[model samples]
Target: MKINVEVDCTPEEARRAVGLPDLTPLHDKYVSMMMETMQGGVPPEMLETMMRSWAPMGEAGMAMWRKLFEGGAKS
Candidate 1:
């Protein structure tokens, strides 16, 4: 059996249909803050911390992957 469905709608419309909360304002604020940080003096450690917080696996997962890759490379 073969079936196809096509959805043609703007992102906002799709989001609304899906009952997702509108995060446009939050996203815009985050982007604006990033821009300001890049233009101003954002410390490297602060940026690193922020990036780590956003990572789903965080430092432990990244460390495991790094070790696996290094072991494979040595083999």
Candidate 2:
């Protein structure tokens, strides 16, 4: 037997239901960094390429990535 699952709610409600906290500040920071890196604004294609390139890496790389993600690497 199979049952249907329905989801009806606003984006905020859906995020809350999944225990996902609102990440407006994080998103804003990401955008600001991307803009700074791009200098004259970043294109969607370049953003996709950046994401794809960084998506596949080991734990060490991920830690480095997170360090950069959280704003620059610690000395």
Candidate 3:
């Protein structure tokens, strides 16, 4: 025997049902900051430095990124 259940609700409702934190505000802030940076309020080198610092696993993060792209290129 098999049982199936269907849920019909908005994404917010689904998130709430799963007990996930609502990150809409944080996402909006991140998008706003990215737009500001892209509009020349921040220099390219400064953005690169910031991204490198935010990367996981410290310096190895860059190596991992390179490998990821390299694998994509081969396919």
Candidate 4:
């Protein structure tokens, strides 16, 4: 047997129902940092190094990123 239920709610409400933590502040900080990088207040290499350090697989993750971009460029 199967039951179907329909519920209408805003995104925030849905997120709360699923017990997801609110990420508004984190998102705001990320956007602000990206904007600073775009304005040259932060060097691209520094941002890349920071991101690479944060990746779980480090160099391997960066290699995958390079491959993805190279494939996109060829297409």
Candidate 5:
């Protein structure tokens, strides 16, 4: 037997499905700090370390980081 599924759920839904809460605010803060670091003219090595250190704890954090970087790259 084979099982198939179409995952069309938002992060919040996925989190809730497994009993989790929204973490957008936390991600937003990270992005804010990253942007600030850039705007404040922080060094590259320092910024990279800061980003890695501030990375979220799990999948949700990773997803947020990706989105943040994508957006940051564009602007």
Candidate 6:
């Protein structure tokens, strides 16, 4: 037996349908903090340490984050 069902919805609607907690607020706060950090609100060593802890994928994750910040800076 095979079944095919399609439900059209926006990403947010899909997330809600799946019972995912809304993280928009948390994401916004995180972005704001990141901006502050990039603008020198936090020291380099502390930022590195924090990134090490937050980026579970280790150096690769850090590199990805580095690319993101670098791109932002270029904008």
Candidate maximizing lDDT: 6
Clashing pairs in 2: none
Off by over 4 Å in 5: 5-7, 48-75
Task: Name the runs in model 2 displaced over 4 angstroms.
Answer: 40-53, 57-75
Clashing pairs in 4: none
Residues 2-74, candidate 5, lDDT per residue (tens digit)? 9998999987788999998788899999879866777887665775565566676765665676687669779
* Tens-digit lDDT string for candidate 2 (1-75): 999999789999989999999998999999888768766655657755676577676666656655664473243
RMSD of each: 8.3, 11.1, 5.9, 4.7, 6.6, 2.0
**Tens-digit per-residue lDDT, 1-75, candidate 3:** 999999899999999999999999999999788666656556656756876877798779867755764584487
How high is the lDDT of residue 16 in model 2?
91
Predicted candidate 4 versus true structure: per-residue lDDT over 8-69, tens digit per residue? 99989999999999999999999788666656665647757866876688788888856864
At residue 24, give the lDDT of candidate 3: 100
Q: Worst 10-residue stretch by lDDT in candidate 2?
A: 66-75
**Candidate 1's residue-wise lDDT over 16-73, tens digit each?**
9999999999999997987777668767677667666665788876566557545844
Return the top candidate by TM-score. 6
lDDT of 4: 0.77
lDDT comparing candidate 5 with the true structure: 0.75
Query: Model-by-model lDDT, in order?
Result: 0.76, 0.72, 0.77, 0.77, 0.75, 0.85
TM-score of each: 0.61, 0.47, 0.56, 0.54, 0.51, 0.75
Q: Which segments of candidate 1 are over 4 A away from where they belong? A: 59-75
Task: Kindly indicate the candidate among 2 and 6 with the higher TM-score.
Answer: 6
So what's the TM-score on candidate 3?
Answer: 0.56
Task: Give the Cα error of residue 57 in candidate 2, in Å.
Answer: 6.2
Cα lDDT for residue 4, candidate 3: 100
Lowest lDDT block of 10, candidate 6: 36-45
